[model samples]
Target: MRIKTTRQQHILRIKTTLRWLLYYLLIFLSFIIMTSGTLYKPILLVPLAIAISINNNIYGSAVTGAFCGFLIDICCGKLFGYNAVILAFFCILTNLVFELYLKNRFINYLMITAVVSYIQCWLDYKFYYQIWDYENVGRIFVRVSLRVWAYTVISAFFMYLLVKLVNKLLMPKEHLTIEEAINTNIQNENKR
Candidate 1:
């Protein structure tokens, strides 16, 4: 009886995990589709962050971060991993500070997008396009950096709206907050 019960619990857990994963994958797909078109000029990063942050997976955030980063690099036709590295780091940091009153407000995320956009744009300008030219470095920095930053911030708002909408279509089950889950386990063990 004990062994059967344990096996059943394991199966149930696996099913729950798989279901959660499938939902996130669909949300990620929809996000890509919405951003790919002419409606938005590649402000996908901010929206990606908003989307990832809504879910319960810490690992998912990083995975989606790299995915979106790679997507941006590919769509914009730039060297690979330029946005991936930065985005992965941002997601990791966001995961770490989830408990620290970090509001999910748009402007807060927009600031993050703007800052990362600045760094990404600068790196692309300095390293990829103007590495040897050296003459137009100043102009490139001013124009490209500002353009990307503005675009990213603007895009962040749209992404927030989309995330809000997507949540209704596919909300994941509440898999307890980290602290709550641990506490519940402890309580159950004490009872046992």
Candidate 2:
């Protein structure tokens, strides 16, 4: 069983810290792009939020989602906590789904991001604009949901690729095979 040397451990720690820093930088850029509002609409925040959630632990994901959502809300001038609440809930939902059913696959992440983006669009229309006219309800829902879903799916692919790339670059490759792990465990036991 090969153990990592002290110098290697220190390098690993630095890499981990840099990886997390890159994550925050990506998230901040997403917030800025989404809030710029130069496009017809923006879906970067939702998919990026979901990507972060998928890559982190449940509580960590929740906190990240809430913080990003809060920034979004402040940028959009919505109710103080509205975006934060919805984003945190969506993050928790996706994290639970990942834990229970979905593998950490790109397709699953894309689908979840699309679904969450659609739901967020619906909520935005309802709360921000109060669009309650029954006659145009179906039309509005179909139009907004599809547009948001499309943009979100596109953005999800980019964010997914970014995560994969950064993880590959910054994280250490786990060289310990199952047999190695078992041997190390036995050796530790003998030492104790």
Candidate 3:
């Protein structure tokens, strides 16, 4: 009985690890696809990271957000850790908001995504273009920043669905039999 319990625990750990790895892989794949030299890159990482934050704990969401932001920095050729910090902060805040105030619904997530994406875009425009006093800053903001924000918000719908599907597929099913439940209870009592 002890050996069987240990084996089951090991298997559960492996499954949990695999699920996290799949999430990271999804982020990497999105990074590659979004940065592949299209006329209008959609800033796909923003929505995807937000979607991830919606489903994960605060620490996990922050780490995922930092990873996504690191990719964004690389894609944009900006200073390292800039987007990472911003994204991590936003991810934590989003997680807290969901935990406290908002329900985890599609429209709610989309609205949050829009706000976060717009803030990112506006900050990028302000620091990189406006502060630098670049010629035609308004034009650049309208053409690039606004478009990127719109595209990112549009992509949020798909990212949210993808995240929901992944979560459903990987989440552990809790259908223990009576005997299994008894064994689990015994194990817990033994630990105490």
Task: Identify the leading candidate in terms of lDDT.
Answer: 3
lDDT of 1: 0.63
**Top model number, TM-score:** 3
Give the alpha carbon lDDT tens digit for every residue of 98-146 in model 1: 5365666656666666676667667777787687887667876666666
lDDT of each: 0.63, 0.79, 0.87
- lDDT winner between 1 and 3, please give it: 3
The residue-by-residue lDDT of candidate 3 on 1-36, one tens digit each, is 333455666776776687788888889889898779
> What residue pairs are clashing in model 1?
none
- Give me the runs in candidate 1 sitting further than 4 Å from their true place: 1-40, 173-192
TM-score of 3: 0.84
By lDDT rank, best first, the candidates go 3, 2, 1
Report the lDDT of model 3 for residue 87. Answer: 94
Instruction: Give TM per candidate.
Output: 0.65, 0.78, 0.84
Give the C-alpha miss distance for residue 167 in model 3, angstroms. 0.4
